[model samples]
Target: MAIVTPLKTAAEQTLVQQFAEAKGELPGGPAVRKLREDAFAGFEAKGLPHRRLESWRYTDLRSLLREARPLADGAKETEAVTARLASLSLTGLRLVLIDGVFAPELSALDAIPEGVTVHSLADALVQPRDDLGRILSGPSVGADDAGLALNTALMRDGVFVEIAEGTELSQPIVIIALASAESERAVFSRSVVLAGKGAKGTVVEVSEAAGSAAQQVNGAIVFETGDESEIQHVRLLTRQQAASVEVQSLLVTVGASAKFDSFALVCNAGTVRQQHFVRFAGEHSEIGLRGVNLINKAQHSDVTLIVDHAVPHGTSRELYKTIAGGEATGVFQGKVVVRPHAQKTDGGMKSNALLLNEGATMFNKPELEIFADDVVCGHGATVAQIDGDQLFYLMARGLPRVQAEALVLQAFAGEAAEFIADEAVRELVMGEVEGWLHAREAAAEVSTV
Candidate 1:
């Protein structure tokens, strides 16, 4: 019998050539370069994640990504880009990245918040700290993932933040990763956050587009929480171009007696995947993960996560809400793992989706892998259309059909958004939801007209 090798996809071939050409120019010392080489080797072996892989069955990158765009160059903060960045500003310590390159002029680095230290990843890599490799390597949960491997191999620049022990930040830290429509290219960035023991703070990451050009952004953020610390993270993925592709991952390791809470809002994205890989590294920790996905008009959105209970007395709660209208598609894949010695673990997960029309689609896959008998774990999922009774009740009360539907959808998605610990952040998320609903209503009116 003769053995034959599979043909490489165009994207894979382009990525290989890019790596070989840019290997020497990428930041980092020998150790970091070796790490990148190893990561690219892994990707070269696996190729792009396809439907054959159980984890990537729903959103197949191999099929979706026809060809690879050239690597993003150093983008100039043009007048238009500056105006766009200004509009997305929030009241906090803001760090901005344009085309995956750190923009110091736009970032609020001159203030130097009291107990917090920030550095550009590119600078850190060139200097090469001992722990930098470990941080960039990421946790075991997603270390072997193909997308993550590619990110590690090509990651150019991102923000690195450290909070001093026992320090409480006065305001949230906002990091914005914005794409430049002037360049049709790919951007890969990796960011890290280290919360010292007993410290408390909130971090918000906003991934938005500068204009209506198609681009690719593959980014990852790693978070490590110390014992007795509390950290709140909010990720808002919005206003993506219709033909753009975005893959973002959150990798976290929670410490003993610490509290970690995260929320993600996905709206108006083209092809997007928001994944989370979390591990309870210490005992007696608690985590809450929640998200809402609003997609319509041929958009594709996916939220996949894995929560690992590697220690005893860990607790996790997850809930996700999705609204798919027009010809959009939404997917939620969640799994919770309880190690054999992870006794006294408590976990609960639920996914609820509302389809606004016959053309919309939703996929929910919830699973649990428990090796411990002394644990409490359960999962549930529900998918349905708007409740006719509720809609009728609103309409009979003098509200128009569009307004009634919007109200109903708002209430349905509010349960997940209300979990944000910060009042202002929660409201900001709701505002995005309202904006999406308004757009939906306008589109409906146009269709009827």
Candidate 2:
């Protein structure tokens, strides 16, 4: 018999040890225990996904992550966190999580309205629900996905939200995740959102971190849009830094006649990856996924999506834009699947990138798989620099070269930013865009001087 040795990276070794040391203290009962064991076993088998996997070719975790930071001390509240949270200045129903643990002291937990039910993941783990397991490991997601599996095994705490049937919320639920300053810890968190039948609501997923030290954060959100319900979601990444790694995933299931809209903005210098898996379980559902990535100065950001149209009369649209400057790299990948029974399914995907400098990079892959002849599906991707003619046209109007470039980039990113329904949230994203534009302008001036 021949024995084979498995090659493992230092991060993988540390992760295996972390699982072993903390498995007993982690939340969830027997069921969750088994799930965690299985998930970790699977993750151990695969290790971290490498460039060999086409799905992860653009952003290879093995090479990108040389080692693992300490498992996050979820209980340790980072100092200056209050000041950091104050910067966003968010109001109206906020659920705050620090280092992946839900913090009632810092959140609007008491002010939640009557129509929605809010609970903590730790509380749920005390008596896990059968549905909670299903929500955590949905069919749309593969059990062996490294990032997700790690999150499943190690997730400490987060929020669970349930909107009652036919109850529309007056205030948008705001979720703020904060990373403590100078903590070299890896944080994993998970949340579930259920929009009951005929219910309507919006959830804002926001985050802030102290980039003084390197930190890794992995989080997941699962959404179930009930029949005829509507859901609006947006994810905003705060701060651009050179020393952070973020992997966030979203899984959504749209019920019959339900509408789902999601937007994500990536304007940070941190190495980040965002993934989405959306499924249409019922007929006549509509879903839209849009995002913008603004990265510069050697940052690497990736966005990947999979939209599965399993039934008939479903519609999905996706638009993603990227702005890469300096040595920054941006990636976008989208795949739409229309099953045989999914007749009358309509799916369209478009991705565009604007490279602002010679060293910038953008990678895009859009795919459509249609088994039903009655379905309409198409995909497109584009990459280009700012047009000289457009720059000239703007400069002719008394605008400086830097200002002209900002206008063009804003318009490029606006195609997706405009889809945000909440005016305040939309304005927040636009404001970030403006700040990024100003930063670029300042850098240009400094270089010339």
Candidate 3:
């Protein structure tokens, strides 16, 4: 008999040990112990993901994790945190997570819409409902990703939002996740949102870090929309300069005549990877996905998507654009599949990228698998540099070379930024892009002079 050596990575081992230790310290009874043990077992069965996993080939976490430690528990709740909150001017029912732990004192939950409930996932597990298990355990038709599995095993605390039938929320709900250290620790969080029949609402999720945080943060969000419902979701990721790894998964199911739209912005993270899986289970459902990423320095950002049309008369569209410079790397992979019975399916996907420097890199893969003879599905990808003619025109009109270059970069990025429906959110993302461009130009000037 041949002996088999365990192929677990160091980070996976460390997480397993930490979970075991934490499980013993919880104040719950036997049932809680069982739940903890079962979760750990699931984690052990599926270890760290590797390059063989198609979704994670370009963004490998096992090889990137040089050290591992437990994340600081409730270390971000301080008087100084108020100052940080004041700068953003966010107005909504806020749920704050400081260093991956919920901060009840900083959170504002009063005056929320009726028929809508928001609470921590740990708290929701104790409630009486079969929907959580049914929705979470469903089979994923997309790639078998390890980052998602790791997030499931190690997730500490995140939001759980559910809307009752026929409820319409006037104000958007905000979930804020903040990281405040540059340690070698890891943060794994999860968020789940479910909308009942005829329900309509909006959700805004934002992630930020204090400074250079050499940590790992993984997240997963599952949205379920019923018949005649609508949901608008926005996700923003802006981490620090140090090495960071994040995996965000969105699983959405649209019912008959339902509409779901989502916009994502990824800026300045060490290594950020996101996957979106949207399935149209009922006829006449509509869905749209838009994303913009601005990566600089040695950062890496990857966005992968899969849209499955299971029924007839379904339509879906996806557009993603990326801007990379200063040795940065970006990746976009999108796939649309239409079943044979799903006739009259209309789907289109486009991915474009701008590489500002020779060291910057981008990889785009758009694929379509159509079984229906009458379906209309198409995909396109483009990778190119700024137009020399445009640059020369701006420089000849009395604009400095650096300023002209910045304007051109902004225009290239603005194509995707203009898709943001919310005016405030669009302005915020544009400001971040401008800041990045200005910093790059300044660095270039100093190097040249």
Candidate 4:
């Protein structure tokens, strides 16, 4: 059979053109227009991503887009989704963005203390400041990053959060991206967060589909941290068999004695891809990167990251764990680079996977590129199955065979869940892990019998 070429729908074309036209009318006018035009030009040159692209080899966008078009605008307010917000059991300020557009009516922001500001990008763009423009167009030439360009051209609305200097938010701030009836259509969104000097806060980003509807979501997140400030970021994606793609870039300019910690969880989605870029340019800065992924059936999950050490006396550590079953595939590619002038750099990376079936697959590539003589860097990858002996021991202790299997699976995934700092969040993720294992074991038993 010959492969058929997919044509772009009229809606998609119109969406692209709308973005190109909006650039000219932006608040910043000509300068911002030039930046948007340049990015759009790059995107046009590259076209849509294909399987031939090395970075996108596992994700075939051409095939996925054959039937999808640019998502329609979402509803101004969705009460059904707003009612479900209580289920999150979260404490602190809650900001809602429905289908890429910021919805202040459905959000709860009373907890945000003084000295902090949270508003939509559309509002921020009108402010008489060039900083936002500068950061939005900071990507250099020859970057060859397709997702960033696509987002630049199609971003409808995003969140702009700024934590003032020396202000510390005691409670975590929750940003919820809710997809409702209107969002059942396709949507593209972006979010930017800035932590000012000597500021400290925690942010949790949650994305979920409202009902049993098919939709496409593409998103990007940009984080900027300043000197002596600390930021903890958590990202969670939960959708029911819906195709979603997310590209996250974290840019941290650490000041003396600063720290940054990040956690990413990709549990349920038709297709998910995440990229993390961390650059350390300050002395005595520390960064910790951690992620946990649980994939099943035809799901695909990929996590690619780059950690650059460009200064002296910096440290970074990354640990990623994946559980794959039922023909699922997981990919992890990590690179740590130490420049020649970066002395006293300490970096370590490890990727581990648990395969529940022979059909499941995992690809891990961990690398270190060092130019300095006084730096210490190391990386390792491991793939294995559940220990039969451990399962046997549990079964021998009077537990049923299925119960024993579930316990072993929990033990394997619990290692990564232990790192979650929030007790409530940790418990919620652990419960999900157990539920997945139970469902898998029951299915296996039915097939065998």
* C-alpha local distance difference test of each model: 0.91, 0.86, 0.78, 0.74
Candidate 2 clash figure, as a count: 1
- Give Cα distance to truth, residue 156, candidate 1, Å: 0.3
Summarize candidate 2's per-residue lDDT along 336-380 as a digit string, tens digits. Answer: 988899999989999999998799999989988889999788999
Order of models, best lDDT first: 1, 2, 3, 4
lDDT of 1: 0.91
lDDT tens readout by residue for model 1, 1-449: 99776789999999999999988899899999999999999999999988898888899999989999999867567766788777874778899888888898999898668999999888888874888787787668887789989999999999989999998987889998888766578999989999999999899999988855788889999999999999999999998888888999899999999999999999989999888999999999999999999999999999999999999999999999999988999999999999999999999999999999999999999999999999999999999999999999999999989999999999999999998887888889999999999988998899899
- The ten-residue window of minimal lDDT in model 3 covers 24-33
Ranking by TM-score: 1, 2, 3, 4
Across 295-365, the per-residue lDDT of candidate 4 in tens digits comes to: 98878888877787878899998998899988888999888888899999999999999898899999998
The most accurate candidate by lDDT is 1
Kindly indicate the candidate among 1 and 2 with the higher lDDT. Answer: 1
RMSD of each: 1.1, 1.3, 2.6, 3.8
Q: lDDT tens string, model 3, 9-95?
A: 787778777776665543233554454466567657756666666766787767877556675555465544566666776566788
State how far residue 244 of model 3 sits from its true place (Å).
Answer: 1.6
Candidate 3 regions exceeding 4 Å error are 1-6, 24-46
Q: Candidate 4: where are CA atoms >4 Å away?
A: 1-29, 137-143, 182-184, 243-253, 442-449
- Per-structure clash totals for the candidates: 0, 1, 0, 1
